[model samples]
Target: MQKLKIAIITLITLLSAKTSLAQQYMKFSWKDLNIDYSAFAYLIDSENVIVRINSTQSGVLKLAEAAGKLRVHPGYSSKARVLEIGIGEVIYSKDNKMSGSFPAFRLFQENYDPVTNKVSGRSYVAQATKIAQKGYLSSRPDVKVQVYNKLSDVQQNVNAAAYFLKEEAYYKQFAKPSSPATNNNTSTNNNSGNKPAASQAATPVTVHLVLVGDTKDASIGESVKSDLIKMRSLFQNTMSVNKNIKFNIKEISGDQLISTNVENTVKSLTVGSNDAIILYYSGHGSNPKGSNSDFPTAAMIKSSYKLENMGNLVSNRNPRLAIVIGDLCNSVPRTRTALPDQPLMRSAPAQHDPARVAQLLIKAKGKIVSTSSSYDEYSYSLGNNGAFTNSFVDALTSAINSHSNMSATWDAVLKQSYKEAYNKTRDIVNKTGTKGQNGFYRGSVAYN
Candidate 1:
């Protein structure tokens, strides 16, 4: 009798665990220009959710009745509370009146049916996963309410079906412990923090310098190869002074020849650890269109910027300083459609990308981001190379008329460089035509 009783208890415990695991929960979806909670709800409802439009006064009351009848187990209703939304909040009710009472019960913890429309059940799971991956859960419990509500409407029977779906996605991306694959890849990234004893013994702070120029479209056009020379020569001079510090000057390779090489160049420079990096780019540039909707508006480079592969380089976490000199024409813009929040524009090819430069700057810790234009300005080339490049050379050679800390020295030089580049580009464009003038922009930003 005792053995039989123990067996029964174990069976019951196992069954309870299974039941708990199967419970359903709400899945949160962010509002985009294309879709939101209403659409998400339709997708969660077993893909058979019917579109219910509240066009008449009677229809809303019917919705209230339907909503009120739902029960997780017994009399519990799954309606949402009347809470303040951004800007303002509207009280949802079965009756359209300012004072008269009507059915206003909230949905079950897992139900989030909108008052106006019911969504079909195809887009909800996808939206929920997206919101969770962005790391916003700690701040928004309402998202939890909204998600589980959708699950109850799905008829999944489990209270946590939607929540599990989102959890599965998050675990896939971040669950793995550190492994050999991650380590080997780290080595290839040349991002090692360890330095030779000699290197460590030298400078208190080292600057990572990334110098790129001669963009694919305007590579001195082959005609100037022999007759012309780099106007600014100090790019190599200043960094050579410190043997302890290293500079990874990127070489043009294969397809990278056509795009912004900042990503690869930084990868080479950041190998091991240092103090700071001075990143500079010169070549052709153009504006990326801003998005008309929620989707990112991409930057359309005259040449490719290879923004996507930049992930490896932008992951740096060390304290560093950066000096970005963009000598290419049309490198800056007025506004962008793609905000940093959305990573949608990563699809564009290398030559026309806008996010590469901005993304890299964002990842560098203790950094500053300088550009070559006002929101409406353009940058331009000087004599042989671009004006920004010439100024960079002059600054390093004289250390901006000082031998003190490299940071202050570089800052002074960049200021002068921006002024010179702006004036020179503008004058040249004025003489050429308005079309040329539109392409002339300048900026000197210090990143630390």
Candidate 2:
């Protein structure tokens, strides 16, 4: 318990005492539209608005699903594909309507024709409505989310063109700095007397979010994007009570996540004694030649950032503490039962070697590193989130809020995350197997 308490406090106390901004919100716009509605499809509008949340921070887009009810789709990021979120009626009303009076909104994947493999008949509004009335809606949804592999189903009810245009225009205007981005929310310290009593030095806690989103790679999907947003939200909620830490976050994302850019970004930053660094990567994780192999080398991955190289970069920085997590397929398969429902639209489970996994862990040894998949089992992602990373974010946020004192340590946090990722990826394989929820059906009678 003492070790755990120190570990938690060490992480929190390392931040600089001064105030700084977090990369909290990203103004989103439609970047791609691949909704699976076939050549001939019905275009209808059910319920939507330009977008507004009375308060600045609204995290209400975290509930209701029908790709089989109450499912959670982690964050997603793509260069070509973009999905914007809508504000539910729950945000507008203050009557606590959600408890009973006001029903919950449902989100089901649009259905496809069993024979043609094209989305047949369905309105986005109707699908969402059904989930509100019929699906297993949660008063407090805690189910492990199984990411829908087919993204077109996730945005089943959206109007591609119109939505893209509206959000793009809106983001262009909103992201622009208003009045030189000035803020009047600072309070004066008023230490006018003698020398201010030699105050304690503010520790510098730099959180670098090095994310890679290969939207062009269909395999990558939206998980990367969602991981970025959710990670920030998790930290925000967890650190809300601790005012002593000053946070500085730098995002090396999109095309900039290449090796050169990543290296340069690290070089440009400075870390003082007792300072800490938090590193997160969610793109593609590969091992020796992208195939089954013997023990892996330090930097075997061929994506934006190499595994070993990333570890070394942080070590050179010499931060008092660091956590580097990689959510990708190292695919070292130990024998596990095959995923269910393959005859339908499911992909086979990946085989990974445990020895290879150990090699990858070697590079991350000093930095509390974690991989999404073990030996050769391919990891999964959904929406704008990497499946493992989403679970990771959830575990951290939940751990922080678990005890009022924030007493949980790095081990506890990592344990919660790894367990969740294992279960989530396995469930996705099973549920998405033969006879899946790829189509939609509305009964003659309403759900309620």
Candidate 3:
């Protein structure tokens, strides 16, 4: 309370002292400053823009600014609600509404109004946080009503004409002509979580485990694919213990896989109903059109094999599920150069979509594609195995061991795997300050 009062005094002083709109900052408290939630832009420089606003809990996060919508990172914040509007850090009024360096957050509120009433707004905030976290709150029945409520707050805020004006000049710094690539929370594998029920008749399930990588051109497979390969045995062994699942895993590698045979291998697969095909590619990839390009265009490719349509090919067989994950670069820059260590994975192969190439390998509705890094970022490796692939295996294995009905709980496997991979990789990146590889699930985000 003391701090809030002090801030109040400071803001009043600052407001009175400064007559220019270009002031560095205006410190204020939540108590008296009833300014409804508005868009804010922090200009780090002419090129780098940081978009932010306060939420109920996660504070201000680094928002991906584009169009008129702030995308992703809504679940992450620094725990501070202050906007620190200065040094190009801005929020402005335009035409009578909020428009500026940042877009008004897609504040979907239900069950209450936030701007008019503080208590109801708090409830809305709690629900928004829950939605941002998704399935993690499945067990929290108490909050379900608010969380599941429709996206009405945004409309409500607009209808009441309670919206703030947008500062167009500052907003132009971050807004893009094209819509930005959406945040991907897609997870590839969920085969580990569910076990077919005992009462269910024994049905042979066909699963194809395709390991795509380069072992010859500085074989990343030695480090990236080995543990994943070893874990395959554990996966099969665990699956085999069940008399119901008759599974077969075929790993294709060497110079042959690196050649034209890559496409042939995927195109030749045979899958039956209730079948699943898992494609794990540990190599380099790129987003040719740029990171802002749609996900299908960011194909992660290599010299050894044609993996672009792997997911689609598998899905064509009408398998029950398709899992495609790429441990490689999914660059966002217009001009993406391949890492110096890689030869075949060119520097942003033009018109290539690594997600489709690497992740959407099958293009089936039942598929999940997760990648290690977004465009313009590099992936990390410890010894030989990739940080993403290693964490992915550990998460899935743990989920599998804890559950038995794999058929009924594939999504559970995906959730845990996605969470583990993201957290493990995020930890390393945060600690090392590494600039590439923050893995994300392309389907629905399973991580809390």
Top TM-score hit: 2
- The residue-level lDDT of candidate 3 at 64 comes to 18
Score every model by TM-score.
0.35, 0.46, 0.42
Q: How do the residues 169-226 of candidate 2 rate in per-residue lDDT, one tens digit apiece? A: 2222223232452457654453332211221223323344444343234445334544
lDDT of 1 by residue, 1-448 (tens): 1111000000000112112322233333333233233211222111011111111242332111011112222232224221101100111223533222221212223333444223322221122223335543223323222433332344443222211111222112223333466444446522244322332233434445554444333333211110111221122222332234343444342234444455545655544353555544444444444522111111324445522122224436343443434443332332211111110011111121111222122223443344444333344433223445444444443342223233333345556556654544554433224422221212233433
Steric collisions counted per model? 59, 35, 48
lDDT of 1: 0.30
The lDDT values for all models are 0.30, 0.36, 0.38
The positional error of residue 326 in candidate 1, measured at the CA in angstroms, is 2.0
If both were scored by lDDT, which would come out higher, candidate 1 or candidate 2? 2
> 179-230, model 3: which lDDT tens digit per residue?
5547585444434335234312345555677766544435354454443443
RMSD of each: 24.8, 19.3, 23.1
TM-score of 3: 0.42
**Given candidate 3, what's the lDDT at residue 296?**
22
The list of candidate 2 runs beyond 4 A from truth reads: 1-83, 86-209, 236-240, 289-304, 332-366, 402-407, 427-448
